[model samples]
Target: MAEVHRVEEKTFEFEVPVVIVGAGAAGLVAALAAREAGADVLVIERDSVPRGSTALSAGLIPAPGTRFQKAAGIEDSPGLFARDILAKAHDEPDGDQVALVTREIGPAIEWLADNHGLAFSVIDDFTYPGHSARRMHGLPQRSGEELIDALRQAAEAAGIEILCDAHVTDLWADATGRVLGLGLVRPDGSTDEVGCGELILACNGYGGNKALVAEHVPSLSDALYFGHEGNQGDAILWGEALGAASRHLGGHQGHGSVAHPAGILISWATVTEGGFQVNLNGERFSNEAKGYSEQAAEVLRQPEGLAYTVFDERIAGIVRQFEDFRRAEAMGIILTADTPEALAERMNVPSGMLAETFAEVSRLKAEGARDGFGRDFSGVADLAAPYHAVRVTGALFHTQGGLVVDDAARVLTRDGAVLPNLYATGGAACGVSGKDASGYLSGNGLLTAVALGRLAGQAAGRRVAIPASA
Candidate 1:
């Protein structure tokens, strides 16, 4: 671990109505909602606000039933969303946290679009394979930075105080084992204790810290992280030290076919549906019509656990229209050659096998066989010369595990006891999607982050600041 500069002993005393750890999507939402409910909220972050994974993500807000849904003529309900989420949670997930996310996702998404001025379009639910509903909500800005900026702006306008570069090293519990405050190590090598009426943990996942990754998520200990670099799982560690248990510790979505080398995330919409993906052997593997989650697992099944996308000048033009092209090129999956045989050689595959693979693809395209990809692959197939290949591989997204919380977003311990005054939401809490889907559910992360964050904020406000006392 890098030695972060800690501030000196400073007793910064404030009657903080709520202390929020981590200013990512979940934390930001919690802070904003809590403040709007008339609580003096403070958000302590390890990094500058608007710089966490939430800031770096594609700003796709997945609200099931909103004005946007009506505008797009899509049918959905909170109940349906909950059913899909619960189905996934049944497979190796924390049941309580999953339930919380499902119960509140619709309302949370509505809150963002309604209260936060988030411009979004309700298309079919972002379809990970196995999803029954077309439930993905896409943002006009299409970047996590926009969402972060909007959330932070809302929080600031509501008179919330955001402390940046303050790493939360430990949780401050009362004598009765209730969380009261936090131990903050600032950037200047100084230490300060900030008191709070309630604490909300939203510090995100442990993908960035190798040691923590091994300690928690053993499945992907060596897995590459495609999210922000600041998600080090501090909240999880602190919660564990204070006798809080976690779920899905070694479990997360292995996002399929990210833009390699560029470290940017591209929706599976583009790769599985838009681009041509192949295995390391320079041959097409699974049916491209499957969901990205299923495609990601098949790709990992390769000898090197990676795949590549091969396209011609025609597909290249399509890829160029998107801004994530740089990332595609960096991952070594996107390469160009003069002919099919040469392209195969560049990827170190059997030349004859490559030729046969392309021939089979051409035959399949001509036949117009349904591959179950819906309409996303309507125009794909049938490519010409100037071939290109993009190395597609799986990457660890948010962990679907952490401190368990109920539908109200209250943290629950191993023995089913509610940890009073301590609430958790977002990636810091366990994910709602479980084994029901092959990969992470498309919009569940954002959904739970906003929904559970709101629930926690509201509950924390009621618990910490009583109306009678006020």
Candidate 2:
């Protein structure tokens, strides 16, 4: 057995059935489920505030076969959802894992709604790319902050203790790879120890860590990272130290239409609702329908790493239901014009070229012609009068890769052996989006977070009793 280091300082030590790191979507949901399964759970967060990348998201979760989908008269199944994911991630490394998440996502959402009293409604206005069914669900406010708030409320009501500003510096595990507990650095510069029967790493990914970005996802190293700074990859480091295998290290989610200077998301609904991105030359460079994550690289390659999202009043109206778009509009970030020429002038692009681009889009829609950039305009209508535009740039939202795990959310070793008493979910675990940004189907992040989190929590809760030291 490896020698265990003992802390001599007069601080504090506590024991629980499960000790979770990070207080984001994953940790909170895990705590709820574990407590439901009769385990004593505690959550530790590095930040004083609990918000992480999940709060910065649109809070969309894709769950097929949900009660909301059935009530909306949409026929769907986990098999169909798995097919959509596999089709998008054409050579996905872990098809079984993708299928596992798909199977559990619906029940996870139902559990949140029924057991926890969290409310969600389907996003029926527009369908996100790569999903055959309209199954994206969100809070009434359609914001991640709202979802996090709901989860936090549910956790608190369940008596789950969440300690913020407590940074976990180390995991104490025996030589057999059984996690014993964690070392925490308190806000007052004091050190403490927490002993638990199980540990769940939910601290998110390494998108904010420049060195990790360069090492695993070099192509996106230069792009602006919009994820929370707290996602410094503590889970990856600790998992690796315990010989946990990692997968899909290059996979990430990127947003292509973050409003430049204004620093707010323009909502992909603009592009999905017949809007298009143009470079400084006022030319369409790529298919706008490829989805935000896939089109991020193309947007980054534009001149000065900037582009403009051009849409019409019809498109704007269709997307304005989203709070992010509404917020952007209220902030006066969305520029409006009566003609393509005026819009181009407002955007500082070539007026004639912009007009020509608009004409081409109209011609394609009229003649049923395939776009030169490989976009299918059959489903999209031409832009009418009263144009809208938002100057935009691409950004890495979060990394989708981390510790490898099985269907139970149990972290695994390089040789495919399970790490006893340790689990991971959310950005700390490998996602189902293959190994790059292009394979990220919408809502994969939160789906994995909630589904795997619930599974990990239940599994941990049922296995061990609270330590007598508590």
Which candidate should be chosen as best, given TM-score against the real structure?
A: 2
Question: Which window of 10 residues has the lowest lDDT sum in candidate 2?
Answer: 1-10
**CA lDDT scores, all candidates in order:** 0.68, 0.88
For candidate 2, give the lDDT. 0.88
Predicted candidate 2 versus true structure: per-residue lDDT over 1-470, tens digit per residue: 11234333322367777899989999999999899989989999988878888889988899999999988988889999999998887768588898899999999999999999989889887889999999999888788988998999999999999999898887677777887777888779997888888899888999989999999888778998888987888898888888999998899999899999777877887888788899989999999888899777888999998999999999888777678888998898899999999999999999999999999988888887788778888867778889999999899999998899998999999999999889999999999888898889989899899999999999888787554464
Find the number of clashing residue pairs for candidate 1: 30
What TM-score do all the candidates reach, one by one? 0.83, 0.96
- Which window of ten consecutive residues has the lowest lDDT sum in model 1? 1-10
In model 2, pairs of residues that clash are none
